[model samples]
Target: MPFLTAAVVLVGALGLVNLLLTLGLTRRMRQYGHLLDGLEPAERGASTRPVGSDVSPFTATAVDGTVVGLDWFREPTLVGFFSPGCSACKDVLPGFVAAAATKRALAVVEKGPEPADEYVEPLAKVATVLVDDQAHEAITAFAVRAFPAVCAVDSQGVITETGVQVARPSAAVPA
Candidate 1:
């Protein structure tokens, strides 16, 4: 009877230790999750470019190595920042292509020197495609912290709308 009671106590103590260890591990995991959340701009709630900011001064190099400047934003334009390496960028590309038919569109492909052969022709069919080496100039100017971002620029070269998703503005029908 004495030996059985000792064994029971031992098992109970082991169980308690496991419970405490699990609790500690769970707390540490939550802390790690919060730290990871801060790593992403969207998860950290960071502000991208504010609406009404002008993007006219920004420039990106076109596929043909021609300099595309602010004049491209003279009309209501949709500017998309994308990367061949980003899965999210590839996912939204079809929508970006669809939006191009309704508006003037430009796709700024991030991370130059990487072969984006597969994405080039499709994006070029709908928009002026530009390759941004290091994405320093255009990304910094537009305050784009994330790939697959889309912004609507008004005729005055001011950003009227912005989002991670590419969507076309609603058009008014003739009465």
Candidate 2:
């Protein structure tokens, strides 16, 4: 009878330990969730370069044969990185075009298995377009880590804002 009582006590002690461990684990997970909630998209691993960084020097040939480099951004410019087969890139293309309509913009398209004509045709209307194959000079220069990354850069080549969509210029009110 004593042995049976000890066995029961041992099982109860193990159950208590398990409950305490589970409660600790749950509390830790909640703390981690709160920490993640405090982070911004950029801090959470979005692929675009962070704001306040300078655009690295790079020279790439646009479709029109223009040699584009830091000098090209003599005015505020919107730059977008894209890939041919990325659905997200396609979804954001129109928004990028609209945002680039009245601003200096550059579109860098990474070559994929499919043709880039789908992306090139419309983007060319609003921005200088570059189709990059092996030489990803422009892509590397922008520190682009994912497709469809966009950034608004100042004339001095410092990135002012960056995200999955171009930052539209605020409308000015006439005095």
Candidate 3:
């Protein structure tokens, strides 16, 4: 029947249109992905001080009342910037604490509305903990642009490694 033929043609035409539309959307997604890949870290607002950069001069008191500054890095040290307001910071805390336990580490926590006890307690066990308020000095000194920023600084006060996650130092092999 002609009606059946017409219906078949209509269905085939709709299928062809759907295929074309899907292809167009996929092509657009690829184009967007390429565009995103071309963006810089600074452009994306995730840039942090690069490795080999010197830490800016700063002094602050840790929760234990010890004065901390660049001079405090007399040995290779792991430094982490965290915030109570950031969920990512919470996720990173456990690992940071574990890693800090084995190395000389400093943990800077940005003050939030709630008490800092949640962050300070565990961090203090493994690191010299500093709880900083607005425009946190330690955060500025390290030029961190994102929460949970971490770095390894050498004795000379130059950052040697910087990232969201740094490789944990391996334990020394006993002779």
Can you give the TM-score per candidate against the true fold? 0.65, 0.71, 0.69
Give all candidates' CA lDDT scores: 0.72, 0.80, 0.79
lDDT of 1 by residue, 1-175 (tens): 9999999999999999999999999999988886676563543312248677877376667776667677766678787787777888878888877887566877777764456765677878877787646245677778887777887777777777788776443331001
Superposition error at 154 for model 2 (Å): 0.5
Best by TM-score: 2
Q: List model 2 lDDT by residue over 9-113, tens digit each.
A: 999999999999999999999888966876655463357678889889999889988888989888888888889889989888888888767677888999877
lDDT-based ranking, best first? 2, 3, 1
Whichever of 1 and 2 has more lDDT, that candidate is 2
Q: Candidate 1, overall lDDT?
A: 0.72
Give the 10-residue window scoring lowest on summed lDDT in candidate 1: 166-175
Native-to-model Cα distance after best TM-score fit, residue 48 in candidate 2, in Å: 2.2
RMSD of each: 6.5, 6.3, 6.1
Residues forming the 10-long window of minimal summed lDDT in candidate 3: 166-175
- Clash count for candidate 1 is 0
Q: Which residue segments of model 2 deviate by more than 4 Å?
A: 1-45, 167-175
Number of the candidate with higher lDDT, 1 or 3:
3
Which residue pairs clash within candidate 1?
Answer: none
